[model samples]
Target chain A: MTLVESLSTGTGFWNPLAWLIAVLVAAVIVYLIRQRGESGYKKGTTQTVPFISGNPEPEKEMVHVRASNLYWGYLDALKGYYNFIVPAHTGVLNDYVLWYLGTTAALFVVVVFI
Target chain B: MFWNLPFIAVVALSLIGLATIVIKKNLIKIFLGITIFESAVNLFLISLGYRAGGIAPIFTSAPSTDMVLATPQALTLTSIVIGVATSALLLSFAVIIWKKYGTINTDEIRRLRE
Candidate 1:
């Protein structure tokens, strides 16, 4: 259990105690910084409203960002890849099973041949 | 044929599960399919450890005889724990999705795409 002397194990090694100490130091630093920062946030005030260059605030639903919209540019760039992939994820359970069966069948054939 | 029954059951169970996952439209049904799939895998693992007239690998007073492999049982236990956690997490996600989108239909939960 006390393998921390050199921590090497032929191929790789890890020191749990060292990692714990490092994490503790990092947490302390973050806590100190947060404690020192100005706490100027006030609820139900103009400060609470999101800044949008004086534009009228959008509806709450419109203002909220959904997960799907987060990667528009990346998805657009890889449109071809997504075109092939997204349809495959049609959210239909049977199609998903078909994919799994197809993969298993392919692997079985490969293993049998090999 | 009798000895091979468990292996055949594993295949049947997994295939049925896959079919359910592919054909089911309800989120809960899909989840049930996943659980079935997990059960089939667990069954397969447990079956691999079977031995004729083998005793459980306990170190108690009984004279040590041919023991069923303990590794697969241990692995199956771990898998069951993981499966429970996974199902809980997935179900929670489903609940959250329903609350946010007012539906549990995978097809309709495409808000991210917008």
Candidate 2:
């Protein structure tokens, strides 16, 4: 069979070529939109800072919030649902593995029983 | 048509994701790139199960399984839900970063420990 015939005859919905074309079109559109030129900045020549009459610059101090404190706030807001919350992301490899495994199992069950 | 949809979707998604990562400076936008890739993979998986004449897998007074493939639909749902969760978590991280640094640009968020 000719290549054209092969391409046209097997026009099933599950065609890989069609998927590829769709992906290509989407990607190209995104790229094109992103590449569009930005409008010129319209900033005034005067670069004077905003005046806070009489008020000082609040000590120019850096406020550092501890990770632990942040975690506490999040946990408190979540209440009991996500009790095992932590102060910082551990980036733990094991945790990721466990999460993926659990999700896979859940999906499997859902698909089978759905 | 059906068989090619996923392939095209994946390619398109990959391109979009890559463009997002390349062009966006905001941490949140970068995270969006990852999520875009995730969506593309999910679409590919769903496309994998597409059948020209398969019927929906619903049990209620439904048509025969002549034009539906239940596996892809179920998997797509699972992936979409997971995507939502991941997006929420990423957004939370973005918020925290904004609070800490008062900016979302990756270049400016260098104060925190790697």
Best by DockQ: 1
Please write out the lDDT profile of model 1 over residues A1-114, one tens digit for every residue: 456654788899877788989999999999999999999988899998779999998888997899988989998999999889777666544555578788989999999999
TM-score of each: 0.56, 0.45
Clashing pairs in 1: A68-B112, A93-B21, A93-B22, A94-B22, A94-B23
User: Residue A15 deviation, candidate 2, in Å?
Assistant: 62
Candidate 1 per-residue lDDT, tens place, B1-114, comes to 888999999999998887778777778888999999999999999999888788889868447765666999999999999999999998998898788888877667654431
TM-score of 2: 0.45
| DockQ, Cα level, model 1 | 0.19
- For residues A39-74, could you state the per-residue lDDT of candidate 2 as single tens digits? 555677433444568555354444466566677876
Q: Candidate 1 at B73: error in angstroms?
A: 0.7
Candidate 1: chain B TM-score equals 0.91
* Interface RMSD of the candidates, in order: 3.9, 9.9
Candidate 1 runs further than 4 Å off: A1-97, A107-114
**DockQ of every candidate:** 0.19, 0.02
Displacement of residue A73 (Cα, Å) in model 2 is 46
Poorest lDDT segment (10 consecutive residues) of candidate 1 chain A: A88-97
lDDT of 2 by residue, B41-67 (tens): 887888788676666677775665454
